[model samples]
Target: MLRRVDSWTRTLRHAKPSSSESVRLVVERLSHEGRGVVRPGGKVGFVAGALPGESIEARLVERHRRFDEYRLLDVVEASPRRVTPACPIVERCGGCDLQHLDHDAQLDHKTAVLRELMSRTAGLEPAVPEAPLRSPPFGYRRRARLAWHVPRRGAPRLGFRQAGSREIVALAACPVLDPVLASLPGRLQPVLASLRRPRQLGHVELTVSESGDGRPWPVLYLHLVEALAAEDRARVAGFAAAEGAYLYLGLADQRAECVYRPEPQAPGYLLPESGLRLTFEPGDFLQGNAAVNRAMVRRVVEWLSGDGVRRVVDAFCGLGNFALPLAAAGLAVEGYEGDAALVDRARRNAADLGLDDRARFSVRDLDADAGLPDGVDAVLLDPPRTGAAALAAALAARPVPVVAYVSCAPATLTRDAAVLAGAGYRLERLAAVDMFPQTAHIEAMALFTR
Candidate 1:
């Protein structure tokens, strides 16, 4: 009877497809994260690297009660919008998604996602969605954080984390990064491997700032679990000197100490259009794509440049990216940020530009009931991903004539848009900003007015 029962169990197992089994599926659409959505056996499945309207064979990697996860094995039918990914390890690298999709289609996808969220969540839609703010699909990223790991055995690995994994995908080059930053990983690999305690080095962040002559001024921040030896420090300094890159050593306390500097001045980027230059220290929040940031700043100034708009409030302002420019555009701007360090930096930047009288920076906790400043004609907010629900509620109570919201997450943006709508603010203009290309991430600018 036991043998008979075992035989029946075997038969039942073969009756249906099991986990890790390959199955053919037709992708219905792309999820917000750029994963292809499908339904197999009446269960939703998310398959990475599978385009919408394509038939593909995928292996079930994970099974959950509501949805399944799949790894693409073969594409039986490919979408016309698909293209060969530029990165050889795009499949495994977590740095970028939607690389296989055409660049134009990527913009369309982002706009569609934004519209869907606004219509569904906010119950509002723009009369006309503005064209997406464009950026070069490749070599546009000005900043990158790479993970470095020294395995128990084998050469030390340095690159981005693997997709959906903590494992590091060692890279020789990354095309999406700025040209100067793209080559650093390969060159730094050997230097990191030479360290006495390589595993002590947790990660490295690379940022590229352009000099006045259009030369790349690269900065490297080395995050360490423990202090490096004098010899190791010297070796890393030697590499920085050779590359003409500024170096900062991040200690266990999360303080970055400048170890090497080729110039007396701190590294920063210029908004030539605004005739302003802003300097920032290591770990400061900066927009990754400089060109897009400039365009974004310009758009913000233009959108707020209406008659009778004399004073503006910039919330969650970091180093005065928008406030300084607005002041340059002849508006009195009050910039508020949570980080005291950033607030100080913004003030210094304003002073350097001689816009201190017009632009003032204050350190305020936006998460709390930090009421909006009075006598401000317009409000501009660029909140982090948690998305200014508290601030949105505050804005609902005290509605401004115009509110420009810069959002990185559409879901949260729509959630806040609902609050503004309740306060009788109509969605005026909405545009997708291609701030980070070759990725599923979306940045949007929305204008709301009473």
Candidate 2:
């Protein structure tokens, strides 16, 4: 679907491609990579996703040498409506990028981009596009990784990387995070300070649970290069109590050095709004935005309300995040996951939530034979970055009347969208959620119905 530009057009002075050609151009549109495109005379300069129609100064971030490449450098005339970002390290933290824009505006940009991608990238007609579903933009992320660095020249820091770089960004606090975990940095430094060489620490894992008081606790995974002293063990225990973080010293890996650390707790998070819960160990998959997740669940439920779906198959179901909630709502749900551990955990969660009767879990590699349950009314899939190509092919041949495809990446979704369109499933809805604010990541939900 790439539009082939004529070589003659390329020779035009305005359309000439060069790295040194610089001009302050208005951001006309956002590309799939979350960069803004500027029509400087004729050639296009891809800037980091700045708002469309907004005039901003940008510098070249990369150049093909033969082609124009640039990154947004400054927002001198930031949209008056642009609000100050909530995260103290918003300028440096690589985790999010759209926080400066109003939440609603971000949602709008994401929605339009998805639609445009479908039209431009997949050759789909704009008029034939689906209605998009919207989700809450904040406090929805249940999983995140924090980098570990000891304080020598400055305070020990734990936060995300800077945008477009691997360099760790020092942060005072992350506003989008659950309040419980946000206070961790202050308390964690003192605990790590006792280590012989504190700066050698590597990483931290944080996950929030919806149970009990809805606290965001660290399943503290410390990556240390050396063993902990006996005094360090006692210090770790005291720090866990004081910081409310469950400490696990890596004796072999990064956190095993502390002998006095308590038992390690697995990283798990719950989605109460959907009557569902997902359990994952450190570094596993979980949605970045929590509020948007609730909104996504609500949207699915709303669609189900009218679909008359009974037998449901959730392909690539992660810990029954969607299947369990749907089952709890009276739909018989058969959930599938690639990981056996996740399958077992999903079953346990269903039993604990009293939703076992309606929900069931199975472990199957989705890339292999998709042995589906017969007489299924719908198929819900939340695939990884690659999207669900095989599952889409299977569903195309099945009698599934409704299909909900949730994707974190749009390009792959569009590829699968083309395949689905060929298989008779019509693109019905595409909703964008600002899950990682101040960052380029976009979470989208697409519904296909035959």
Candidate 3:
């Protein structure tokens, strides 16, 4: 499902080239995915790693009836906006595609991408936000997944997957990693190298949660193919102590064998502003950036409460992120989620906070359900990348005064926005949040009112 540049290379290598020779062209502009666009023979050429206004000799990799793709060979002229990437292994990491582009310019490209997508897909051009909600460009990620690889006879390695390939790019520290996890890959070398069956290791998940006292506590969840031996557990626990992180071991097929700190004392993060601390399962989904997520929640409450919305439904709500905040403000909130485990967690969170009466969480699939909660004046959506297309259509027939949509996928967001517009709702405010600044991903919160 994930697209990669290596797939283009493979297709280019297998197909017969229109000509044995290649052509040189100037990059016109960048596409939404950070590829440079060039038109040759009336066919759009997507050149990865090439910037606009740069001249490059590209080999025709694939030729379709309407357009073609190219592999960048050599740059004859470089764009002035280009600069050296911050990460030494940026070429292989594939995690940050816009690192080579100027930092400030990346923001511009993202904003432009958002605007273009809205116009093309949603048929409405939203007014650009005054500026993107941003934080430090680096060291902002509080969650990361590292792939583990071990050759038949070579030393085992831990890091991220290579661009367009399944191979692992070994590394010690990543610039964008949170401080708690920045040095973990290097520190795990001894553990991975000494494992009895290295092939049984899968990957590592690093998460940082804020304690009740406002201190950051790092947690490590190890994904293994087989059970961890008694000796191996001691070794892992020792490694966790040395790294100042709590450790948890989970097997792919064995749920009963999964072990961590214990029940009721799981790793958790606190939102002091809302007077709430949420504990999530290690495998549950949470926003990657800590600072941005808090700000996003605050913004959502501000928007939802502006028009005196006393009753609201938080669709696709996970762990009561939005529902709890709104309920705290005296609004009766009904949060709907597909995962029963997360719904239980959300209910438990409300009960712990003494808001169980007002903050009600239900387990239901938003994608499948057509009818929404009754007696709600407003709706808050935080769906996955596929977007809330079905929910948006359902709400169209029953218009509300306020609809606050939080989206990570601009294309799908705009598509849903179009549906909401047809239902007499107009876009009121749009704020771009740099959830993952170094990468091309952009998260935004938009308000639609009738």
**Hey, what RMSD does candidate 2 come out at?**
7.2
Candidate no. 2 TM-score: 0.81
Worst 10 residues of 2 by lDDT: 3-12
Report the lDDT tens digits of candidate 1 across residue range 1-450.
110001011111212344756788999999998889999888999887778998887777766789977767777878999888888787677777788899999999999999999999999989768999999999998898988889889999999877656789888889988998888889999999998888779899999876655567889999998889999999999999999999999976676999998777788888989887788988899999999999999999999999989999999999999999999999999999999989999999998889999999988998985598788799998999989898889889988899999998888999999999999999999999999988889999999998
Native-referenced Cα lDDT, model 1: 0.87
What are the lDDT figures for the candidates, one per model? 0.87, 0.66, 0.80
User: Largest TM-score belongs to which candidate?
Assistant: 1
List residue ranges in candidate 1 displaced over 4 A: 1-17
Instruction: Let me know the TM-score candidate 1 reaches against the reference structure.
Output: 0.93
Quick one: best lDDT, which candidate? 1
TM-score of each: 0.93, 0.81, 0.91
Candidate 2 lDDT by residue in tens digits, 1-450: 222211111112223234444356687676655556776656777765466676765555454534466655455455654666666556556666566677766666677777778767656653335444444455545556778766458766667776656667765566666666665665666567566566555676666644333555655656555655667666766777665566655544332332232334344565676644555554446676666667677777766656578888888888777887787778998888998877887898788778888899988899886656778888888888988878877876664788888888888888888877777777776666566754556767777788
Ranking by TM-score: 1, 3, 2
Model 3 scores what on Cα lDDT?
0.80
